[model samples]
Target chain A: MGPSLLLRAEGLKRQLGDRLLWSQLNLVLAAGDRLGLVAPSGAGKTLLLRALALLDPLQAGTISLQGRPPATWGLPRWRSMVLYLAQRPTAHGGTVEANLRSPWEFQELRGRGGWRYERIKGWLQALGRDPSFLAYDAERLSGGELQLLALLRALQFDPSVLLLDEPTASLDGATTAALEALLIEWLAAGQRACVFTSHDSEQIQRFATRTLELRP
Target chain B: MTPMTSGALTISDGRLALSALLILVNVGLSAALRLGLTRSLLVASLRMVVQLLLVGFVLEWLFRQDHAPLIVLVGAAMAMIAGISAVQRTRRRFAGIYLNSLLSVMASSALVTGLAVTGLIQPQPWYDPQYLIPLLGMVLGNTLNGISLGLDRFMEGLRSGRDQVETALALGATRWEACQEVVRDAIRVAMIPTINSMMVMGLVSLPGMMTGQILQGATPDAAVRYQIVILFMIASATALGVFGVVGLAYGRLTSADHQLRLDRLVG
Candidate 1:
């Protein structure tokens, strides 16, 4: 593994019951890499992302972050560094700010100096939202707004690698562009990388530096 | 039948048969109302009578035995049955559910009952079947209910709220952090019945053991003291039992790697 490699997966395999989804899959993520994943429906794209984040079990494979296996870093720390963002995000019954702040309650993230309200407000501004957006009830937010909230929630944690699964499916074009710009700015700041899937080919071409296709 | 020296009335076989005939009234009502419960009513009544009679004979024999190990064996058997019945009452199950229930029910009931028998009541020989058996039975009964309700709620909550749980996990929440709310909800639900019963215990209804003791010629004051102690023991046992079962369930449903292992759950 090179010093620039952020994550690596080797000989990954997954099977759903009696049917084989995929096997012998490999991925390498380096710093500032924006890797777009393309796969047909039922091609196990989401499962691949989940497997990379260790959210779901793998039949046979090894995933390492910064050349260290998950066992050495421990599950919580490993997941904190390599986070997954779901397509349809869920929010607890509280204000948007509460949803964003919820991740800090975990012991693994507690010592990261906690979330900065000003930094979130700044991100919200970049996403074209005002400060009062934090006060809105999270459960009552529209789908697009919820997606923004989910993005903010993950971004605030400062993860090393983000596995985004159709994060902008519900967002309109303008909001989606803002989100992409925000992500670009985020990538430029640190040795961060992202693996995302988009149904829109134009968006993928515009955003991803390179692309990987999964054939069933 | 002969009356006891304490003047407690003894029911003869003929009188007991007369009491058994009372179920005809339920059967008649069910028939008239077209409720279709007549067969079930009759079968349930018969089952209750047969089961109680068997238990009566068993208790009589058990009370006569002077061996401590035999008495302990019977208590262990009761706890085992209670444990199995607890899991059987749940709608959802996972692998190791039976073992989890057995460990929780047995440990909590035994702990509370042992403390009450040896420390508080201080019965002669400490394992006297007369005192230890009934106390253990009462504790086990209530603890079983708590474990069943707690486990059921925990599993159901996880199934229904999978999205929310996974959301938390995706954001790097630990297994306990992801599940703390459901675990709290389960424990609260399990403790509700016990708390409600305690609230209305004396005013709403005289407890069964108290009534039985009074009928057996014990003074009302002595029976009341025993009932109070029994109530306290039951509450402690139920709290501990609910905690134990919920904690065990949390372990089963989540992994050390901070993953939510919902696949381990089965209907």
Candidate 2:
């Protein structure tokens, strides 16, 4: 009967010099709620994703997870709980394996656990990718392939929240449907939630339980 | 009267002309390559020739001054120019910061060379242009390149893929932790050519320093000592200059909040 708070933003406003990007914006997400954020180009969708990931400075507002402010949660803990996947994944400019393993060197992951390289192979197989894809350079990956591989890598963290910016923009209809099913299954397995942005109305209609429009 | 011929040393007019001609050809071909770099090369060539000639005249005058302060001033100027050039090649905005780093490198480098030349090599009038100037020039030039490479890549790495950098920061990585890979990779790449040179110095090539020393009437054994010392001094100077520039430039490249100020790059 009562709403739970997984992530909450209050009175959020961002401005660059005299130009305001977003103002008086507010959002909240609870477990198992798959939300879609829709906006036109330059509506700061990507900026908002980054800001939610604690990767950008907010002009004014407070973001809280589980009722505790991010300042109190600390960056490492907050970021681990909310993994932001960009439209174009920033490949490490190296081999696929290197890109996948890049985050292991971060302070939060360092010495925490050893990578299960075999699980990576299984995930790739499940995603219709070959294990040998690991040997190829990231720069050589196709847009669709990159998004898929990046998704697999992000899942390695098992974050409670996945913030995806147009994750399937380059995917074909079949692949998009498959990915939607996969995401639904993932969210259904636990109370984890996902907030994503996309321009595909068909995919949004199929995958999103709730949609929010940020119009310019 | 031909200048006094000593030992196996003979400065032939034809040999000097040949060397000059080779340098000219190298410059010409490099400029002629239609690589959008012709203008920059021509400007750099003219600048180098004029600057070196002017330095020759100035150093000749300073060598006669017999004052320690004058010699120090000459060395300081050399260091300052090297630093400024290094900074310029790395995008040219933070001239003052890079100059300070360069001067620090030069002072340390010159101190090492000065001590060795005076104490061990015992070259009378230790500021002898024939010895001190050439050694300083070689060491400073190599170090300047290392500094430029390190600083350039460090800044570029930070500016591009800034989100990934921030991701690392958000993941509780310290400032150094966030930057460790790019910094290490830049420094390693900067040292690569130098490392290869050191490895292949004697087998694949006759180094300019040794050849110059031998041509100037020094024995092969004596020349080798100077060459070895110069090589070690260059490595020291390069590492020091690179580290110094990277550390200082990192501050200028980033904002107070430790985020890279991309606007500062173009500004």
Candidate 3:
């Protein structure tokens, strides 16, 4: 049998007024699994990602993470373990380091729970960037730079589950390839599981252990 | 430039020239900045010039007649214009709702200032052209600014960061709890400039009313007393007008269910 399921969704449904976005959806993400969610524009991929992150309420049925129902888990605890990277990848405050370390400001990260400075620096280097970028203003960063920063921020949470929406949509080819290599390394480490959505089929085939498509 | 003497323009010679020059300088600076606000600046300048000239002639006529109803009519028209100006400055998602908000602002400001000046200050002839017109204008104008700032910031906060706001809601936050951050920011921004201006009024700068009074040859002590009274009236009017319009507009922007009407905004 596969590793114990880290997340499970059953009979999940959402309706925006009269329009049904998703219905009767079922999914399970096991530990170490790298899952890719594919959908056409407006097929509610972002909504589903948000729902899985417990940022959006599912209209029907249930979702559980690590055998605890979302209703049972404390909000801060749930969010700490399940980091979500939104599509926009925009950060609120000044400086790249400040954005990357935003979770540190959260009450949940108090006392030995802070993101390791060394690990963050290492990751930045791996992404072909350095400590120099950390001092740069977040608003001044290009889209690709912001996207990478957002991914780095998610990783800083030390989450058991990472949900990213089109994380590479703005990246250059070299950065995209580097991101794929990072994903492979992350999966190989077997410490965290990831679920992401992307339009590039080649990247999906290379990185996605299993893929699910959201239909119109 | 036309070789024209300043006195030929109107009865109040130097004061008119100064006000006109100040307005022209503001307009020129706005154009230089390429703020895409030339149309608004031009229209506002034209409105101020024409309105002041017309009001001057009308007040001259009213003073000669010494009739109360005609003076009250002028005040009412000024209040109406002030209300409309407040609404135009406020950026709302549903622009159609601005009319109601504007009316609310006007009513609140007018009721507060009208009662204070006419009933309490009670200048001779109660509707004296000197006291009634300028005092009412200051109160109405300041209140208009507060109304605009409060409404505009509130709507902008709702529009931009909508996803985060909705996320808070989905996290079982009450509607007020979900919107608390935005509300706080908007209200703080709206109140700050007013508070700052009031704090710095006498020391850093003499306000427009006081300056006008000084220029018009009123004693400095008398001008200061009128300024103090007018300032108090304006502060009260601004608070009431801003609060009323914001409270009403906030309710109307959301449905009974408390979802933001995103599509309704032309912005």
Best by lDDT: 1
Model 2: residues with Cα > 4 Å off, grouped in runs: A1-3, A15-19, A90-102, A110-141, A188-191, B1-53, B65-70, B91-134, B155-181, B200-212, B247-264
lDDT (CA) for every model shown? 0.90, 0.74, 0.73
| Interface DockQ of each model | 0.74, 0.25, 0.06
iRMS value of model 2?
3.2
Estimate, for each residue in B1-267, the C-alpha lDDT of model 1 and write its tens digit.
111226468999999999988899999999999999999998899999999999999988887888988988899999999999999999988999999999998899989999998899888878888899999999999999999999999999999888898888877778888888999999999999999999999899899999988898888898899999999999999999999989998998898777888899987
The TM-scores of all predictions, comma-separated, are: 0.95, 0.75, 0.62
The runs of at least 3 residues in candidate 1 whose Cα sits more than 4 Å from the true structure, single-residue gaps closed, are A1-3, B1-7
Interface RMSD of each: 1.1, 3.2, 6.3
- For the candidates in turn, chain A alone yields TM-scores of 0.97, 0.90, 0.93
How do the candidates rank by lDDT, highest first? 1, 2, 3
How many clashes show up in model 3? Answer: 0
Best by TM-score: 1
* Model 1 accuracy (lDDT, Cα): 0.90
